[model samples]
Target: MIGGFFDRYCGDWSPDEQALFEALLEEQDVDIMAWAIGTQPVPERFAGDMMIKLQRLDYLPIDR
Candidate 1:
């Protein structure tokens, strides 16, 4: 899931978005998954357009 997210969005990300993603990488995998799946509330620091896109999960393959 994370790989799909990175592949789809990382190419055009700004430096700040890149940094935010890097910081997200440091979080627990479960927390990231929860946030992406809308099972957990995203923290204020991580709440924004990027996170909103992540929550959409639209980049994922349809077959999956």
Candidate 2:
């Protein structure tokens, strides 16, 4: 549910923008990782779909 909101805003965003959002929102870990892809620091369990979604939507950052 919350991830939906995050991904929703990630649409049409640049890689840098996406990274910013994720970094800013990655304060806590999520339990619903069924659709998740990958984590920045790499969480114990991450949703692969989430990573692809962010990358596809250009929500992920390039280098920072």
Highest TM-score model number: 1
lDDT of each: 0.95, 0.50
User: Local error of candidate 1 at 8, Å?
Assistant: 0.3
Cα displacement (angstroms), candidate 2, residue 15, comes to 1.4
Q: Write the per-residue lDDT of candidate 2 for residues 1-64, one digit (tens) a residue.
A: 4455475766766797667556646555452333343334444333344455544535544575
Which ranges in model 1 have alpha carbons more than 4 Å from their true place? none
Which tens-of-lDDT digit does each residue in 1-64 have in candidate 1?
A: 8999999999999999999999999999999999999899999999999999999989988973
